[model samples]
Structure formats: C-alpha cells, structure tokens
Target: MTGSTVGSATAARGLRWLGRWLLRAKCWLALLLLTAVTVWWLSQELILVAVVVAVGVSPGLVGATWVAASPRSFERLAAGPWRRLRWRRVITSRWEAVCRDAHLAERRRVERRSLTGERMITESWRCPRLARVRTTSHAMELIIRARSGQTVTELEAGAERIGSIFDAVAVRCWPVSGSTVAIELIMRDVLITPTIGTEPDGLVVDTVRLGRTQAGRDWLLPITGRHTLCVGASGSGKGSVLWGICCGLAPAVHADLVRLWGVDLKAGVELATGRHLFSAFARTADEAVRVLATLAEVTEQRGQAMAGRTRQHRPAPSDPLHVLVIDELAALTAYAPAEVKKEADRLLARILTQGRALGVVVVAFVQDPRKEIVGMRGLFTQTVALRLRSGEETSMVLGDGMAKLAPAHRISPATPGVGWLVEDTGSTDRVRADYWSDDQIRQVATRFRTGVQAVLITPTEPVDRQRERSRRVRTPKAGAA
Candidate 1:
C-alpha cells in the first residue's frame, strides 16, 4: 500500500506483460527484421541476384547435406520438430471451432450486476482446452483437458467428426486421467502393407513377434501364460494369426521347450499342411474331443504337480509349455453333435480356466463370437478381434463399448490380419499379423519339426469303401435279381 511498494509492483507487472507480448509476437518481429534486411540488401543488384539464387538452390543443398550427414538425425532434430510445430499451430487455430462443431463445447447463461447496480445476462461457451499436440510419421496425438462439464463419452462420440474435419483416416480417444483425454488421429494406414512372418532368435516363450502395430511398433503376442482367442470373419486373416504364432514358436518347439497340438476341425484341411510341427493333430469331431480331453487332463495333472511346489510353471525341456491351437472353434463348440459338443465345451472350459498357470495355453480361432456359440469366451485372457460383422460382435469379443475405441468392425475386408488386440487390463491396440503362405508354413515346419509325429485318429474305413459296402447291402444279390 506504500507509494514505493506500489511503484515496484506496477513495474514488475509491466515487465511481465511486456515479456509475454514479445514472446507472442516473436515470429512476426523476426519476419519484419528479415524483410528490412532484405530490402536494404536488395539496393545492390548483385546482392539481390545472389539472394534469389540462394533461395532457389537452398532446398537441393539442404537435401544433399542431409544425405551426406545422418538422415535419422535430420529427421529427429529438424524435420520432426518442424512438422510437430506446424501441426500444433494448425490444430490450435481450429481447436475452438472444432470443439463447438463436435458439441464438446459447453454453454452457460450468466447473470451479473454491473457497477450501475443493474442486472445483466450474458451467454458464454466453454470449449475443451488442447493441452498438447504430438506428431509421428503417420499420426497426430492430441492431449485435451476436458472442461468443467465435459465427459469422455462426449469426446469419444465426436471423434469421427473430428477425424473427418481433420482429414484423418481414423480417430481414437482414451482417458489419460480423471480430467484429461488423449486422442490419436491416424493420418495414414501403416498396416496396409503386409509383412511376412519372421522366426524369432531363440526360445522365446513369453511373447512372440506377430507383426507391427499401427504405431509401427513390434506387435508381440504373449503366449506363455495367456490364452488367446482370435475371432474374425472367414478370410479375415485368422490363418495369418495362427501361423504367425506357430512360426514364432518354431525355435521353442525344436528345442523341446514348447509343445504344439493342433485341432483343425475343418477335416484337417488347415492343420495338415504343417503336421510336422504338431505333437498331436486332430481333424474329426471325435478326434478333436479326445484331444481337448487329453489336454484338460494334462492341465489338471500339472496343476496338482505344481500346487505347492511353485506358483508359476516354467518352460524347460523336461516340462515344456503346451500350446493347443484350435481352428474353427465353433465346429466343436457349436456345430458338432450333442455328445461331442457337450464334452468339448466342458473340456475347453476347464483348460481355459486352469491352464494359464499350468503351462497349457489354448489359441482358438473362430468366425463367430456369439456367447451362445463360444460360451467360455470370457475365460480367455487375451482377445484378438479381426474384421467383424458388427459393433455387437466387437463388443462381445473385446468387452462392451470397445467398438467405438478400437472399431474392429470398421476394418476393411481388403486388409486381412488387421485387428484390435484387447488385453486383460482393458487396453486396446490396433495390430496386424504377419502373413504366412503355405510354402512358408511348410518350410518353417520342416526346418523346425518337433520330430514327435502326431497320433492322427482317422476313420476306420475309407469313405468310398464304406459307401460301396452300404450300396451292396441295400441292393439284392445278382442271382436273386
């Protein structure tokens, strides 16, 4: 309140305001200074000509320099930063309007009394604040601080409109904190290019490299103590996921650290090609049931063996991890006879529930994800949802309301193997499995054969011979005729 104190405080406030103003106007000040220098230099014709030539050749010179130097350094130090700054400016310029258009802006009516003691009514709009913007090679991430009355649901509902306005291929929003949300705008389709399956370095039993995530990170599927259920429509690259896991496990199988059992209920049309890789292969309904029962029994025995000894099962040559891969799970769970279906469901339920800690894991692939068909779907810890028929199916596979976040239903049919991976913690990521051709499968299987031939339980008689016998029994003898 003293005169000198007030003067000092006023001066401090003035200095702070001037600093902020200068910071805001720095770019324009730089441009003005550059223009003034250019005008002064252009008074000389030679200097003007040199400036023009330099402007014309600078791009090529920079390009050559980048090529000569480290390209990655240039990208990280120069190009990436510039792109991020430019996108930040662009997004900031349109943030308010975008929020208003998307219905994320809250409006309120304010009543106040002015200095004249008169009542005044005013309307105000509150838009969500853009906290930060980060850019990658193929995507933009926007971190938003929600306004007082805003909810994450409102933000999620407006994601599509935001993506369309920003010319993004897709948009996903997730809550980062109680009042903050992160939105990812996918600018390009990174998963469009299919990649071939690659063998892992050694016996990697915990997680296997499947393919690349949408962010171009390695997509590793955890198989050691996880039961994975992959649900996709027919021709939606279910085979790619199946073979990707098998290929990654090839080394482990060869080293006797992992054992693979295949149950292809499509009459061996799928698993027969890679039979050498499996310790036991089942094709018919009866065979598949027996295989499930056997695995279930093994799981029980392992659980009893490791009950008090150890809490977790460790993979070794003597006690290897058992991976049972079932193709077309609906065949045994839904479409089989009553006896087979009941027995298979019971056995699968037991295995899926108890096998995770016992070193017995099941990777089942199915087209239908209906609860009635795969009632034990909830038991699987990891769910991979490929191109599905509807949002309903996506929710069924990945839990409720995940369709909006992951949107496996929106995956294009042209891009097989592209799907959403839902982990047990309720986080979702978009991933693509590496494609494995028949030739590649055969090659990998041959190179890493377990040398433990499967016990194939085929029919007793050939179909043609059985048909001939039936025909002769129905027909009269030649002499009687």
Candidate 2:
C-alpha cells in the first residue's frame, strides 16, 4: 500500500510539472533558476549568510511597503510534460460539464492536431432595428468566419465597429480570428448626440442607459478635451443643446475660475445672462474676433511658460477655465471680413488643438456648419446636429453623406431648441437637447451685467467695467479735456 501511494504521488507531481511547463513555461523557468541560485548560495554557509538573509527578507519588505503590489508567488510553479496533459484534462472536463447530459448535441470526430500558422477573414451583415429605447436605431450585425479549431468566441470580440462618419462603416481588423466561427449581433442605432445632464430623478435621458439610469453606466461624457461644434436648422434645438450646456457651465463658471466670451450675431442678449461672477459677452463679429485673439495671446504665453514642465510636473492654470460657448456663429461669420474671418479661424484652431492643457474650453454654436462657414478645414471637429430647415443644410453641417437624416430629422420653425450632439470623443451618439426660456437667459445674465473688460470694451463696449479706463479716455486726457 505504501509503494502504491508513493507511485500515485510521483505521478501527480509529474502531471503538475507538465501543466506548469505547457501553460506557464516562462514562470517555471525563472522559478527553477531562482531555486538553484538559493540552493547554491546556502551551500556557502557563514560566508554568504548575510546575502542569504538579504534575499530572504527582500520580498516581505517590498510587499509591506505598498498595499497594492503584484504577487511574486505565481512565478514559482514548476514545469514539465505530464502537467500539460493534466491541465488539458481539467479544462476539457469543465467545458464538457456545460454540454454533458443534455443532448449529444454537435459531437465532432476525434482527430490529431494538424494546424500550423493560420488566418481567417470575416464579414457581417447589418440590419436596422428600432432602438430598445428612445434612440434612433438599433443596429445588428451577423458575422461568420472560416477557421479550424473548436473554440469559443464572443459576438463583439469578432466584430469591428467604426463610428464618426455615419450611414456607412468600414470593417477594420477583427478582434479575434478562427475557422468556422459564426456570430450574429445587433449594433445600436446611433445619433449625432444630444447634450447630457443629470436630473434629480434616477432616470437617464436618450437611448443608451447601459444598465442603469442617470449618468450611472450611461454617462459617456469624457472629462478631458476642449472644443465642440453645434449646428442645426431653426427650431432643431441647437439652441436647446446650447442652453443645457450653459446650465451645466453655470455651476462650473460660477466656481469663479475661467472666463466665457460669447458672440451672438443675432444681437440677442439671451446667452449673456448669469450669476455674480467673471464673464464677458460679445455682440458683434469684430468683438468676437477681438476676444478670440486675446485667447490666442494667452495660449501662446502659457505654452512658452510651460515649455519646461513635464506631464507629471505640469501645473494647472491659476484659475479653472474651460468650455467656450459662442451662439449663432453663422451670424458672426457673416459680419467679419474675409481676412478677419481667417484670423479668427486661426485662433479658434489653436484653441481647439491646445486649449485642454491650459484650461481653455470652446463650445461654438452655428445654425449650419456648411463647409463654407467654418471652412473645409476648421476647428469644429466635435459637432451637434440639430433639426435642419432644409436637407441641404443638414447635409452641410452633418456632412453631405449624412443627407439621409435630412428627411428624417428636419426641424420646423417651432422647435426653438432641440437636437443631437457629437461630443469631442469620436462616438456619434445622439440625445435630446435641453433648453431655457428667454427669461432664463435674461436671469442668468443679470449678474454679469456689471460690464465688459477694458480690453474687450475698448473696441466693442460703450463703457468698460473699470470706469477709470473709459470714463477718462472719452473725457480726453486731463490736458486734452
């Protein structure tokens, strides 16, 4: 009985070695080398005693230093052939359990391994289905591939979904490849996106809630980055989206850090409304240009100052600043001279590219982002598609190819505010835009009514906030007066 027991133990040990070698060969090799070195050092006795002690204490000391540490224990498994067979059996057994006793199902003929290097190409058929929620569409893709092994695969794992340019998708590389693998999956019908916010209720607006309501798992807003473009026809809710963003910006801006430069060509004071805080509002195209130029100057100065700072060592701005909100850009564009427009575009370009680090943010709203308005090459990469008055206008703001949405989402004169947003992130999600009454705008601006900055007012305001700068200028220097 003792000899039999010894033989069983020896077999078990051999199997363990085999499993380790086949599954974790690199780890086992390092473990064996370490064991050999320790054994050799121990043989040195008193001469290497300190070295042995040092080695023995190192792991414990390092582990105690940081609570979140990687474990070195898993590196010590032994290796060999029989262990691989044992592990294979364990895996096979578990896999078989899921299929056992049901039906013989799809049993395959047992065969020897015959694969060398192999590759597979896959394709998926897409179908449009009504979205499960309030979204536009729920997309589904069915994919099939050619391969040789009887392995498991996941739906999203073997598919590639590229967004940004919509109504069409190009298949990039699939995540997984195998022979005879087939899968059917439904892709979500997406949108241009709606501005998002958290409501007191736990319910999330729009189509995708993921698994919960509220911002919960559904909040797709990315915290980093600067710049966004909003466009749509009259009543598409482009104004509504801007309103929600302004509402969100209120708490952020009132935190009393950054500056908001608003340019509204409609000559409306709707957006300038707000609390007792730091802010600036521009009513004309020339005024908008001046404000944007000031931002460019700040950007150049900051970049020069931070040239020596590394990413980890970099410091935030002395103030919290982000999210520029410009309403009715088309109107402003109409008034600026071609040269001034070019200069303003250049400054806006810089803001979109480098403003994130310096705490500068931009959220520009235009009725139609036709290639003509922002230029084919412009700063508005992140766009929100609101309702459009014409199919051509929708195509212009959303890309000529997106013309399909024209007949589908066109806006009427009464929409006032409503549309979808395409955030700075590449995803083209759509949501319902929020809004504010004309009264809300006036209320918000009451506090900022203090007046304009001297630099801004010199060219645009009838009077500057600092009475001394303008009060004395118009009065003529003391000698002139």
Clashes of each: 0, 35
RMSD of each: 14.7, 21.9
Give model 1's TM-score versus the native structure: 0.72
What TM-score, over all chains together, does every model reach? 0.72, 0.48
Q: Which candidate is the best by TM-score?
A: 1
Which regions in candidate 2 have their CA more than 4 angstroms from the true location?
Answer: 1-224, 275-278, 310-317, 376-378, 389-418, 421-427, 439-481
State in Å the error of residue 27, model 1: 19
Writing each residue's lDDT as its tens digit, candidate 1 over 294-372 gives: 7877787898899889989999998999999999999989999997888788778888888999999999999999988
Best by lDDT: 1
Model 1 ranges with Cα > 4 A deviation: 1-82, 92-131, 148-161, 390-392, 400-407, 423-428, 451-481
